[model samples]
Target: MNAPTSPHILAAAQRPIPDAFMAALTARFGSQCVTSLAVREQHGRDEGSLTAPPPAAVVYAESTQDVQDAVALCHQHEVPVIAYGAGSSLEGHLLAVQGGISIDVNRMNQVLSIDTEDLTITVQPGITRKQLNEAIKDTGFFFPIDPGADASIGGMASTRASGTNAVRYGTMRENVLALEVVTASGQVIRTGNRAKKSAAGYDLTRLMVGSEGTLGIFTEISLRIYPLPEAVSAAICSFSTIEAAVRTVIETIQLGIPIARVELIDVNAVRMVNAYSKLDLREEPMLLMEFHGSPTGVKEQAEMVQDLASEHGGNAFEWAERPEDRTRLFTARHNAYFAAVASVPACRCITTDTCVPISRLADALLQCVTEADASGIPYFLVGHVGDGNFHFGYLIDPDNDTQRAQAEQLNHQLVQRAIALGGTCTGEHGIGVHKQGFLLEEAGEGAVAMMRAIKQALDPKNILNPGKIFQIG
Candidate 1:
C-alpha cells in the first residue's frame, strides 16, 4: 500500500470565488449566504487532523431549491461546492481543499415522509440520527445505521457508515433505498424508489450512497428502518488480553449468533472513557455487546456468548438491562472518540480504521497493537469487532513532526496488513482527503480509474466537493 499522505499540503489548487457569484448567492440566499470567517472556518475542518483553507463562503441551504441554486451558481463559476452536514467525519471529508463555497445543509432538517407500513422513512438530508430516532420513536421504528456520532442521515449515507450495530443491521449501503440528489449542474433527480428491491437499470442509489458528495449532493434520503427490538440487553465483559476478546467475537460470529452489537474498547480507551464520561468501567480489554430478539432468544444469545467468553478468559458479564442503563453504556461507547481526544491536551488525532475477514482479525489487530505500543505514542483503540472493523486514534502534538510520522507509519502498517488479509483500508469511512492513496492501493488502478471515469461523467465541471475521494487527473 502507498504511504499515508500528509494532510498539511497547501491549497495550491484553490481557485478564486468570483465576486459576481458571491453577489448572486447573497441575492438568492439573503442572510443564508454567509462570508463570516468564523463560519467558513467552522465548515472547513472535520474531526481528524487534516487542515485546509476554509471555503470562500458558506450558504445555509434550507430547501432542495436552495441546494440546486447554490450548485448551479458554483457550476456557472466553476467554483468547488463542498456539502457540509454535522461536521462529524473523521477523514477530512468536509475540508474545502480547493477554494469554494460550502453549502451547509443542516438547516434543511425535516422529515419528508414516513411509510410505517413499508418500514421506510424519507427524510431531508439534515436530520440527524438521534433526531430521526426521536421522530420515529412513537411509530416504534428506529434507524439502525448509527455511526456513533449523531451524524446527519445525508452525511451518514455519504460515508456508507456502519457502526456498533452494523454487524446485525448492515450499513448505509444496505439501509438507504432511494435518494433525491442535486447534480453538479444543479438539476434535481430521484434515484430508485422506496421498494425493497430493484432490478431497474444502474444502481445509482448505491453509487451515490457512499460517493462522499463527489458524484451528487443528497437532498432527500429514503432509508429502511427497523422496529424496536422486543427485548434488548447490553453487557460488558472484561478480557485478560485483547486477543481473547477478539477471539470470542470471532467464535460468536462463526457460530452464526445474531448479535446486534459487539464493540471492543482497549484498556487505554476504557480508562479515558471512565474519566471523560464519569463511568467506572473495568480497566481491561473489554467487549461491550448487545443482544436483540425475543426475551428467550436474547437470553439464549447472551448465554452462548458468555460461554464463549469464558473459554477465552473473559470475566463475568456486567449486564445493562434497563433502557436508561443501556443508553448510558452505549453513550459512553459512542463518546469514545471525544474521550480519547480529551486524554491528550491539544493533540491532533491521526485516526485510522481497517477491517479484515473475521478469521484474520486477531492476527491483524495484535501485530498493530504491538507496533503501536513500541512506538511510544499516546493512542486509544476501539472497534466494532463483530465485523472485524477497528480504529486507532493516535494522539500527537501538532508541533511534533516525529510523533506525526510515527503515527502515520503505524497507520500505514495497519492498513497494509488489513488489505493483505483480504480486508479494506476503510470499512466505513469513505475515501475523503485522508485515504485517497490507500483507496488507490486497495482498489488498484483499473477500479479507481473507473471511479474517476464515473466522477468525470456525472460531474463534468467537478464542482461537487472537488479533490475528495480520489484526486481528479
Candidate 2:
C-alpha cells in the first residue's frame, strides 16, 4: 500500500495579477468577461472556512477553445488561472488568492457522448453529478460517485471526491477513465482512452483526476459507470453509543457484506436533521445503510448487516425501500452539514475529514468523537464508514477565537491519529487551503518534492490553479 499523500497544503505566496492580462481577458471574452467587485467576490471563496481575495475577473468559458484562449492569455502575462466549476468546494479549492481570471465552466455543461456498450459517458466538466445521472438515467446506467453535493464533474475530478456509495462504487479515482485538459500554455491534451485499463504509459488520467487543477484545467471527462441496481433498499439502525455504531460498521465490512452505502450520523446530527429536514429520527448514534442487488440479495445483505448491528446493541433497522422513502433518507444525510450549522445560530461549520484502514476505523472514530465532545464545541458527526471515512463538523461561532482554536486543535490530533493508522489526511475532500499543514505530515518531504517537480514540469509559468494541494515554493 502507498503511504498516504497529504490532502491540503499551505497557500503559496501569490503574485499580483498583471494589468495586461486583464485587458487581454476582457478583449477575448467580451460580454462574458466580468471584473466588477461584486462578480469577482462571487467567484472568490468556497464553502470552506478560508476567505481569500477574489479574482481580478471572471470569464465564463463556453468551450474548450475558450479555456485554451484564456489560458494562453494568462500564460502570456504569467498570471494565475483558476478553474471554476459549480463553486461547491469545501476546502477553498476555488479561492483566487493571487487574483487572476476565473474560468467558469458551467456554460460548458453538455452531454457529449454516452456509449452504453462501454458503459461510459463523456461529458463537459461543468455538468453536475445529478444532471449527469438524469441524462444517462434512461440508458439503464448511472454515474454512482455521489459526493452528497451535486458537485460539478470537473470539480469532482479535481478533488477526487467520493460519497456514501464510495464503498461499493469507488471514488473518482476508480470511476474516472479519461480526461481532456488545457495545459498552462493553452495546449489541449487527452490523458487516456476509453479503455477499461491501461499500462501504455504514465497514468496521466489518474494524476490529473486529483491534481486539483494545479497541473491543468479539466475540459472534459469520461467516466466508467455502472448499471442501475436491480433492487435497492435503505435502512437506519440506531446505536446507543458512537463506538457501537462504528464497531457495527467495522464488523460488517470485515465480514464482506456487500452493502452499497453505510453512513454514521451521531445524536447531534440526528437532532439537526430532525429539525431542519423535519424527519424524526432517533437522536442517537445511527448507521444509515443501503443495499443493492437482486431483491433476494438485497434482503440478505440487509439482514446480515442488521444482525451485525444487533450484536452491538443497535435498534432494529428501519427500512426505506421505496424510491421516495429512500430519497428522504439520503436527502437528510446529504443536508447533514447545513443542518448542523443551521442548528446553532451564527455558527460556521468547520469540518475535519479523515479516513483510516477498516481495521483501525473503530478506534480512530471513537478517539475523534471523544476529543470533539471533550472540547465542548457543538459539533455533528457523520461518516461514509463503509469505506473507513468519516467527517466531523465543528460548529463554531466564527467570532469566537477560543472555539476556533479548540476545533483546530482537535482536528490536528485526529489527523495525526489517522496518519498513524495508515489513512490519508483527506478521504474524499481534496486539500484546498485548510489542510496544508496536515499534508506535510502525511506525505513526506521526498514524495512532496516529486509532486512539486511534476507541477513545475506541467505548469512552468505557475498559471494554472496555483498554491493548491502542495505549494510549488
Candidate 3:
C-alpha cells in the first residue's frame, strides 16, 4: 500500500479557464481553436489506462508563432498548458489534468530541410518517425529511433523514447541535436546549431529532450540521421527457457558484438503474436535479432551469435535475408504491445518499462516475471534485452477494481526490484505521471530538489503540464 501523504502536502486543484482567455484564443486562432467536447475528449487521453479529464479547449498550432501566441495567452491568464503530439504516450504525459489548454502540434508535420552532407535533418515537431523515414528513404539514409507507435518526433523527444534500434543508434537524447522551443512566457529560443559537437554553455538541447513538456514546448527539432547499411539480415532464435534466452543476450552484449537489434519475448508473448499476427513459431522463449553491415560482416556476426545461442540451449535459428521476410519479422516484433493486449478481451494494459545494468538483467527479469506470474495477472513479456531494457504489458479489466489493484501491486514490486538492482524506474520511457513516485525514489531528495529548483526557475507560474513529474507548491 502507498504511504499516506504528510500533512504538509498540498492537494492539486483544477483551475477554471477565464472567459477572456477563451475569447482571445478563439479570435487569434480563428477556426483552429477548438472547444467542442468531442475534440477536447479525444485530446485528453492517450493509449494508456489512466485518462485525466479533458482540456477546456484545444489549439491546433501550425507554426512556431502559433504556439508562441497560444502559450503567451495561456501564461497571461495563468492557466495550465499541456503540449500534445500524436497522443501515443503510454503514460499520462499529454492529459490536461488541471483543465487548461492543450496545444496540439500534429498539424505542424513537415520536413523543413534535409542536409545529406551534414547528415542531419530539421523538421517541424509533429512529423512521425516512419513518415520522416519515408520522406528520406531514397537518400540512402534513415532515422534510427523507432518507439513502435508511429509517434511524433516531438512526443518522442518529450518522453525520450527508445526502442529495438537503441542498442545501435542510441535514444533521442543522443540523436536530437538541437531544438527551437517556446518558453513558459511564449518567447522562442534556439538551443544550438548544426555542429556535430559543441562546448557551448548549459546544454539546453539535452535539457528539453526529456523534459516531458513540463519545461517548454518544442516547436522545431534537428536530428542526426544514419546512412543505410549495405546488408541487413534478421533472424529468430528459440530458447529452452526464459533464463537461457536472457543469458544469451548477456553473453552477446559482453562480447562487444555491434549488433543492430536484439529483442526478447517470452513464450506467452510469442503465442499472442502468433495468434494476432498469424505466424507459426515454436512456443518457447525467443530472441529476435537483426544485423546491419556488409554481407560478409553480417554473416560473421550471425556465426558468432549462433555459437553463443547454442551454448545456452537455444535451437532452430530462422534467418530472413529477403526484404519482405525481414519486414514481416520486425512487424510482428514491433506489434508486441497490441498482440499482448489483444490476447485478453476488454482489458487495459500497463506496460512497465524498467532497465537494469547489463550484468543484473537476468536476475532482475527473473524476479519481475516470477512476481507477475504469481499474481495471477495476465501479461505479455517483451524486452530489448541487448540494452538491459524490457517491458511487461499487464492486462487488466479497466472496470474491475480488484484487477487494477493487482496490476498496480505487480508494477510496484517490479519497479522496486529494478531500483534495488541499480536500475531505473524507466529506461526509454520518460518519467511521466505514473512513475513520479518512483522518480523520487530513484533520483533521491538531492537530485529531485535540484530538478524542482530548475523547474521553478523556468516556469515560475507553474502553468506548464502541472501535476506531472513532481508535485511542487
> After superposition on all CA atoms, how large is the RMSD of candidate 1?
0.9
Q: Write the per-residue lDDT of candidate 2 for residues 324-371, one digit (tens) a residue.
A: 999999999999988987889988778989999998998898878778
| lDDT against the true structure, each candidate | 0.92, 0.88, 0.89
Best by lDDT: 1
Instruction: Judging by TM-score, tell me the better candidate of 1 and 3.
Output: 1
RMSD (Å) of each candidate, 1 decimal: 0.9, 2.9, 2.4
Candidate 1: tens digits of C-alpha lDDT, residues 170-273: 99999999999999999999999998899999999989999999989999999999989999999999999999999999999999999999999999999999
Q: For candidate 1, what is the lDDT?
A: 0.92
Off by over 4 Å in 3: 1-12
Query: lDDT per residue, candidate 3, 1-473, as tens digits?
Result: 37212121122467888999999999999999998999999998888877667889999999999999999998999999999988988877877767798999998999999999999999998999999999999999999998888999999998899999999999999999999999999999999789989998999999888999999999999999999999999999999889999999999999999899999999999999999999998889999999999999999998899899999999999999999998898899888889988999998898799999999999999988888888888898999899999999989888777777778778888888899999998998777677788899889989999999989999999898987888887
